[model samples]
Target: MFPFPPSLPPVATESAEDLAEQSEIEYGTLEGGSTMAFFRDSKIETYQKMWRYMESKRPSVFVPTIEEGVKRVLEGNYAFLMESTMLDYTIQRNCNLTQVGGLLNSNSYGIATPIGSPWRDKISLAILELQEKGIIQMLYSKWWKNTGDVCNRDEKNKDSKANALGVENIG
Candidate 1:
């Protein structure tokens, strides 16, 4: 019988093809079940695409909370595919886990406004102004990169390359 943490060889998870192979390894075994985790309620298009990708390959678990998925990965033999932002936050806090692979797709966040609200234009303009002045970028660097509580990841380590996930090793 396969062990709880199966004795699968280390497989590359840095590309879509690699991830597909990893999923195959997990789902091919007798005890294999749910080697990937996705948040159950996410309606974002990119997230949905990832869900479809994984589901098409094999069945995986959906966790109600992000914390559950994080915990599952920590327990081993699992991968949690999530937004780079949240993945960065979690990796900074928990050194045991690092992001695997780059983003499967790209998306942008928008400031939500009530329907027909007059403040929408004002808020949109302010966000654009911040972007133009690089305030948003500065804030992201401060919180995501330079936080005091963050784990000091080694650049030489392959898995620690979370920041450049989208740019590096695109295959």
Candidate 2:
């Protein structure tokens, strides 16, 4: 189905603009030409650049949610631009996905505790201790890399009850 070169067009070898132009040339917009998709909800500035690029070929191709965007990428002819952490985690979990290029921008994340919460410092210290002991990296490898086929990815298929990701959800 791919009419581009033997190698993928989005490789680190070319600029983002070049990739878009090449794909636009090969597939043409109506034929599901190569396109960049992003989480429509993202407020990040660099992501706006991506939106501009997508707009050039065809604006209607954008996906409204990260989940839907990822699905479209897998379905073909679409490349989903996402935050590095989430993208890396998703790629690690799925053997079929590969990152085409380096990060366009970077952002730092922290373990946020509400203002004046007693657990703030305690949580920070705990994270530091875990990092010092390499537990964080170990967990990253365990969850992201090694899980592979051993883990069931569909949430509905899980046998155990699952809790949501907020402190309020903890038992």
Candidate 3:
């Protein structure tokens, strides 16, 4: 049997009601919506099984860098499926660019690889936008401060009260 990995953080505890609320929020359902009923309708069980199978292995085993992550996500079948689902969910919920940025940052592991030219250009633009807004920061590089200034301004605009919000506001 495999012991739980030390690198994994401790699981947070939640009540049944809290779990239900979290699921509703994640899936973009109204509180007490029929969405919970849909999950109990069997199709969700199949999807869960499929998801477990897909997530059984480490994506980093195949792709290594953020660029690779983008490439794989855009080109690979499995990555495409998951991305499509996420995209649909985001669209349905009317999520904004910041939400997309969070997804991109967290799900980079699934798509990390050497990205193609066109996609790289697009990602570069997104990065520039993200940087300008100060949602991301450059570190350990000579141009860090300069880049930070540009992105900090962008961050200010993207988040109206970013400076006033303090450390807790960071995603």
- Using TM-score, give the best candidate's number: 1
Q: Rate the local accuracy (lDDT) of all candidates.
A: 0.54, 0.49, 0.30
Model 3, 12-31: lDDT tens per residue?
11221222223221211112
Q: Which 10 consecutive residues of model 1 have the lowest summed lDDT?
A: 26-35
After TM-score superposition, the amount by which residue 164's alpha carbon in candidate 3 deviates from its true location, in angstroms, is: 42
Question: How would you encode candidate 1's per-residue C-alpha lDDT over 1-171 as one tens digit per residue?
Answer: 111122223664554445444443332111122223332233544445545665564534445456766776666666655556676677777766666555644558887888999999999999999999999999998988788877776777653553334443333
lDDT of 2: 0.49
Q: Which scores greater on TM-score, model 1 or model 2?
A: 1
Candidate 2 residue-wise lDDT, 59-115, digit = tens:
455555656666666666666655666666666555455555454444566987789
TM-score of 2: 0.57
How far off is model 3, as Cα RMSD?
A: 17.6
Q: Rank the candidates by lDDT, best first.
A: 1, 2, 3
Candidates in order, TM-scores: namely 0.65, 0.57, 0.19
lDDT of 1 at 16: 40
The segments of candidate 3 whose C-alpha lies over 4 angstroms from its true place after superposition are 1-43, 60-69, 81-171
lDDT of 3 at 84: 27
How accurate locally is residue 36 in candidate 2, as Cα lDDT from 0 to 100? 37
TM-score of 3: 0.19
